[model samples]
Target: MFLECQNINFRYPNGSMDVFHDLSFQMKTPGFHALFGPSGVGKTSLARIIVGDFNDYSGVVRSEGMQNLLYSYNLERLPDWSSVGKHLEKITPPSLRDRKNELIASFDMAETMRLRFSQLSLGQQNRVNLIRYLLQDFHLLIMDESLANVDERTREKIILGIKDMFPDTYFLYISHNVIEVSKFCREILVFRNSLKAPQVITVNGQDHKLGQTVSKDKLEQTMLEIMHAS
Candidate 1:
């Protein structure tokens, strides 16, 4: 098993409502997965618990064959004191420099590399921050709306490129874009509405790999299933 969460139940300190109630799920393999649900359904909270940010919750969140589980979100900011290129070059491992350059081109970020972090647009900033995480060594990465403001076309290319370049790494992508998740993720964990039995449903996605196209019929069916589950 890659990750297992058993009987997870949580609530904020002195808060009125429970965030999760007897939520249980597991990821049996390493690949791209998703956490899908309406807003405020404990998606982010559960991610934090998985990454060890919240230990106050009840349940056993365990992982096997996984180390360096990192979380990256859209709003994370890079330091503006240096140029984007310089910051990336400084932190990137020496052996991964070629891969870093390739990603810069793949993400269409070569032009913005010379600019300071604050000088880039919101979408560009998100891409730069994401690249920073990719340069590191991690077993699994939780991307919480990490590609938020990027254009759809560019986002697709970047996602496909990442899937190709890091075939061994695991990703738990969180996005509200139903079509995107249905087309790309290998598995979709759809959360049910609050107070509902069986808080989650695991649906198989198209799991489109690099240079592969998912049929429209299959894509629509996956989307419909996700929507109906939510």
Candidate 2:
């Protein structure tokens, strides 16, 4: 067991309602894990909790065998750069970060490195948005709807690159599409009304269906179905 999260319960300080409760999870290796749910259902909340930003939560999130086993890079405040590859050199260790030039070429972004991030096209910026995380050597990689803002072509290319290049890396991916997300994940974890100790659906295959742990007759409609149905 490389990662363990047990009975994690949390609520915003301003509000008493819990965002998550009694949620348990464990991971042994690097593969993509999608955190899919409708808006305001605590997908961002879960990300914050996992990244050690929200310490007010109950229960322990411990990585016993792996020290500092989590890493996430988001679009907000993206490494401001006149030189795009500067972060590649400054942030990552030399031995592990030698793939800088290769990544630049692979992303088709070598020409734009010298220019500021503001100067890049939308697709170019999206590619750089992803590279920030790809350039690192962290055990758990989390992306919070990172591809939503980009073009379909760029998003597909980036996702393919991530899958092919980072085989050993575990990705905590986030998206709302039940059908689309299944392609990238081996196990589909469903969160229903995720702000309040929601049920989790464990799917056997990469089938993108509206999966629910609680039987339809046994449960009330949740944000998951509500979003899709609407």
Q: Which predicted model would earn the best TM-score? A: 1
What ranges in model 1 sit over 4 Å off?
Answer: none
lDDT, candidate 2, at 198: 40
Error of 2 at 92 (Å): 4.2
TM-score of 2: 0.77
Model 2 alpha-carbon drift over 4 Å, by segment? 70-73, 78-81, 194-198, 204-230
TM-score of 1: 0.98
lDDT (CA) per prediction: 0.92, 0.63
> Could you report the Cα RMSD, in angstroms, for every candidate shown?
0.9, 6.5
Q: Candidate 1 lDDT, tens digit per residue, 105-142?
A: 99999999989989999999999999999999999999
For residue 226, model 2's alpha carbon misses the true position, in angstroms, by: 13
- Among residues 3 or more apart in sequence or in different chains, the pairs in candidate 1 whose N, CA or C atoms overlap within 3 Å are none
lDDT of 2 by residue, 1-230 (tens): 25667887878989967677777776666566677767876777777787788899998887654444454544544456446667556765677655666666777788887777777776677677667667666767678776666666555556666666777666777877664465556554566664434444544224122232333431222334434432
Which pairs of residues collide in candidate 2? Answer: none
